[model samples]
Target chain A: MTILSFNNIEKHDGHTIVFPSFQLSIESGEIVGLMTSINVRTVLLEMLRRKIPVPDQAIAIDGKSIQQLGKSYHQRVGILSIDDGLYERLTVKESLLFYHRLFDSKLPIDGILQLTQLEAKRNVRISKLTFSEKRRVHYAQLLLSDPDIYILEEADQNVDLETKRVLMKVVQELQKNNKAVFVLTSNMDSALAVTNTIYRLDEHGLHKLDVMQQEMEPEDEAVEEEPIVQPVRFEKIPTKVNEKIILFDPPEIDYIESSEGSSQLYIKGDMYQSMFTLNELEQRLLPYGFYRCHRSYIVNLQKVREVITWTRNSYSLVLHDQSSIPLSKTKMAELKEMLGLK
Target chain B: MTFSLKRTLAIFQKDYKDVSKNMYVSFTVIVPLLMAFLYGMQGDMGVDMVYTVINMSLSLVGAYIQCSLIAEEKEKNTLRGLMLSPASTLEILAGKSLLTFVTTILVIVFSAMIIDYQPENIVIVGVAIALSTLFYIGLGTILGLVTKSVMEASVVIMPFFFLFTFGSYATLLAERFPVLKAAEYMPNTQLIELAKEVQTGAGFGDIWSYLAVICVWIAAVFILSYVTFKKRMMD
Candidate 1:
């Protein structure tokens, strides 16, 4: 049965109309990809918010007049938004717990946590966690909701190969459970890799590629052989295997830097932002008063004000101007010692 | 009811938690405390009649602060996460209002204790406070929901704080100023009269007419707030 279907769906903002008309559908156990280079994620979120209604000829969620359903519509729809405002100070477990409350009575908590491999980092705060870990937390929250339909936006951003494998496993599990998956991406590779059913969107419109029925055969082999030895590549002494350095060929530090109180960081490379872990970065920059105040953030010591204990040594570090950074329970004493508070 | 109570209380607790951590929220609450302390020392410095105007004025300020708090949350896009949850808009509003009401109650209790203003009829005093609170809180919610940003909500409500405080204070001014004497017909005057009568241990009979006015006003404001909330939720 079709979980969601949209036909001749048109949308308009107060100023302009974007999608003149669009058609889409998802059945149980199907993996669908909505591929548009434009800002489709925002539109989909708006449609989910019902700020923009679905097309007139569409059936959404059990063919119910979902307009009346209100928040219940969210029950069967799990959205992993690339634009989700991440509360970095919150622990991975705490973050999941917050969303779990909303999605309660829908999925078992333990199962969701296990599926996302976040059980180990349950106590680790997100600011202290890795980018991949944060993405895992977001994915876990979505999966734990156990929605019949899943929507992902730029989902591959933080995912490492292992995490991607886990997510694909999750997609497989959801499909096995008859849940429908819908992923949206600007990356053509991700679009092809994750889904069989592709809705290729452009200015003209969307092209629904029927890869599932094997209508489009594999066009060409993607891999082109790299020469055995390019002089510069070999001269670079491929000795140090740093992902960022390896992936991005930069001879030196080229970056746009921004400061958050004591913390100073730069966005390097044009494609993506990069930074060492606060833990790793803090060690080299301790003389600069840049200390690991939170797991995710290394604040400049100049910003540290006073420390207030949250619940039972779940400490909160107030900045010079009284802005607060959360201190994990485990790191409270270490932080105190580091700051000479002890 | 369970969701309302649980979610409201949870939100209220978190507001306090956020308050404890945020210097700004702390500053807001502490400013009143500090002002109340400063005001206490200047005993009878031409302000003995403050008890007459303080109640309603404080109530409005309380409500405005409450509205702005939620307004900030909305501006942060933080409310969307809660709005998308199982907590319906009603529950969310209830929760927001509950947080505001609690803050209001604390400020009132502090004012009463510090100012040495005690009413004769505690029940009537309580009811008047409750009604007066509900009226302005509903106003705050509507304003908060409609505002484009936190700064906008505050500016939109800035006149209200003055109107609610000074406008209602006209009830007490009626005794001294002839112009304000005409305010006896105003609903605030009736509520103030009710507050005064309660202090004198008067019966509810003396206040029933004003209570009726209070009821009509409350019903109207509550309806407006409900409609605004429903519209925002739909959006």
Candidate 2:
């Protein structure tokens, strides 16, 4: 059995703290969702990769410190990050073969291909595959390794609904094998869809969020016909500007950018510091037409005046104020469809 | 951690397959043979030209191939996958170096054959070439670690290539400018000097210092490259 724990883990970037005294434990057959803010998700992933040394055996795997497990720890833990680190030139079969050889595993290639639904794509070079197909290839590598613990870092982002379904199926299979899975994501809906136990990470530490009991019950036929509408709340966001606290209407803000681990809100030709992270702000302001266009910038869709094509794959969003924000290449088509731009 | 030959060989096999499909790597191999053929056509394939070709093939071409391969992995972000694998650092390093070493040795030997150059003591020349190959491969790995992309690697490695391969002739100016004497300690310079010693039927005892110097250079370069690589991996 595998047991992964974080006991009072603290991580700081210079003077600002990312994770402050967080404690959690995950065991085999359990899938835990770590709801991370957008600003700190990348930092958290980097910390996890380094396996930051925890005091008093705070972080342990299988009753042993990861440091003690040494190089062998990697064999037991598989990581699937947003990058999907894959060799683009190699065909799907060759890529899988290379990883199989690395682990020296006797697992059959056919089994992995079937599990990932990539049997037809086995001969295609990874460069020619779609984004979703590439993600499945990453999943195939994970399934082939069959690690005891799987770390999914923003696995559902930039992927289509079908791909998300396939990934959830893989997670279920992993759970059936009694493997521990830790999912770090900013999307609460996606996180709640996979795991009942959710931990919200914030300034104080990780807090358990109570899953709504209504979600567990089957909807009545009458209720299905008349869906209940959620009340829209447009709260004034509190921001800091030059040590002064200010409350600004959410709709007035043009966008928010993460600068030096803090969110900067652009409003009315001025910038103000926001205490809420980009992830928190995104969730709060999403109802007001705010969309996360890039890793660092969240643009107010209503404020976008034009979409400029910088290159065949690169794009930038120009706001009404003449300020520009980067648009992710993968999100371009979706943005165009949303804007009704043919 | 125990060193696993099986894992190392697996990496070597994969790298061989990958390199075979890479046009840049293929060109690196052919460039040296082309140079050798040109020299053979001129019918002036003397010991000086032979040593120069060996040095160029092992140091210049070896560094280019090794650096580009590693940098390409970094560009594609696949190095992190390898680093996060169960393979130990030694296994990965040895595996990568083994491919470069074998390819470089084959090129060196083939170039020599084309030039009809035969050393008086084959064993001595082989040892020198082997040590030189290790040194150049180490240098290449260092270059790869320091470069962020394959384009940057190609640009950054040019100075080192010229400095090492052409720097041996600095000995000609050593008589007039004593400052140039330090160039004799460079790996390529030692390789050329050792090759000359072997051509004149020098034994192990006669060229032991040159061998020692080359080995020291290799060790120093390997240590530096390993330290930088580990640092980059962690970051």
Candidate 3:
């Protein structure tokens, strides 16, 4: 079931447009990530939190308008902001129990603690817990609320790796329970870590980011094994933005992602679309120290900073700026050999 | 908005543990008891002094503690968490106020014991005190809603504390300054007046006027707090 839906959300800050007619719908058993700048995220969050009604029945919970829902909208949509907001004096168990009762949740206290992985520190005061532990307590509170739709704001930000993994697991668990999850984060990498249905919202409006890397193909590895060395037709990769073709040096490009068949070149943090296909770009840029890290992604080798092994088959290449690109298992072995690492 | 005693008690229980551990707020609860002890040593304290200690307890524990609790929640942003919970506004407010209420009543009882206050009608005095506590809690709620942090709450609450707690004494200057006469209508002053009337064998009928004033204060403060809370909900 579709738990939350909003459309035609237009907001103007004086003469400037904050959001020029935006819309989104989150269904049960789905996790959607909306990645944007901090300013855009703040505006989007304000709209969601205040339920500022717009024309054409824009915001709704289970198809009912926010106005009709009134304050009950909060009961159906739970948001976890960046701040943990746990009482420093209250123990983890005490805090979760308090929210449990407030939410009228029948879920056992120990069950929530175990889900948040805070059972060992159940009796410890929030003040004594580490920063990540406090974040877990906050997640525990939201879990106990058990809203139909969960909107998390930068849940993985500024936490330890363990906490990030714990949050990812919790999101997966929520999805399994048929709860719709919408994550709003400024970091693309964090959004990718959580879910693949990612969208970027900005002044230009909302655009879905092609974050899901195509599954590895057996024949693609053979193609990579034999590099087709060709003369570099042009060192400048051409991309179009505002109808202006901006030529970028091969080294200047951080990565090229093909989403829904069109190639997008990411330089610094900005995105520009290229006219070339991913396969063509891969063949053209291979001599310029670019590698096909994933079926949908071609990354500049100089920009690859670290190789993160998430699981036996899952890997990601962390760029210098901390942005990540998916690395297939076979490609990982090839990249390791290219770096002369046995 | 449905009210749930179970949810309210859950909040009260959480606050009970929270307040006990928060030394900055718990220390304010002791101020009235210490004052009562000092007054008890004086032997045969006057009615004004006895009411002064009781009013101090109401203002300090009732208003100050409630304000700090709400302000701290706002400071840490937990108030938003609670507001978004399934609990109703009344439940959250009542649960939070219940803690301050229990602490204020306990202090009032202990202070009465220490000062050996024997009123003509305990029932009437208790009613006045109870109404006045509601008034203070409302004041605290408004104060907590207006301020963003616990430190800001502490600073913003000082003027209200002095006005409500010492507004009764300010009435003595009414002859010299007629503007000060308005202070006589403060709930704290009405509580003191009702206590004095009870000491003189005044029945509930005779003291209903004083109770009316405190009730008005409660109604006004509660209405204002509700408005402020609604405004702050989005802020």
- For each candidate, report its DockQ versus the true two-chain complex: 0.15, 0.48, 0.62
Tens-place lDDT digits, model 3, residues B1-235: 6678998999999999999998888888788889899989989977889988888888888988888888888888787777777777788888999998999899899989988888888888887888888888898888888888889988987887777667788999999999999988888887888888888888978989999998988999999998988897754
Q: Against the true structure, what is each candidate's TM-score? A: 0.66, 0.76, 0.79
Q: Candidate 2, which CAPRI tier?
A: acceptable
Clashing pairs in 1: A9-A55, A91-A125, A127-A295, A127-A296, A128-A295, A128-A296, A262-A300, A263-A300, A289-A301, B120-B199
- Which regions in candidate 2 have their CA more than 4 angstroms from the true location? A12-17, A212-342, B230-234
Model 2 steric clash pairs: none
TM-score winner between candidates 1 and 2? 2
In angstroms, the error of model 2 at A178 is: 1.3
lDDT of 2 at B213: 96
lDDT per residue for candidate 2 within A40-142, as digits (tens), equals 6776666556645456566778878776777878888888888757877789999899888888777899988887788999999988999999999998887
lDDT of 3 at B229: 81
Best candidate per TM-score, number?
Answer: 3
The C-alpha RMSD in Å for every predicted model, in order, reads: 19.0, 12.4, 11.2
Q: Rank the candidates by lDDT, best first.
A: 3, 2, 1
Q: Worst ten-residue run, lDDT, model 1 chain A?
A: A235-244
Score candidate 3 by DockQ.
Answer: 0.62
Candidate by candidate, in order, the iRMS in Å equals 3.0, 1.3, 1.5
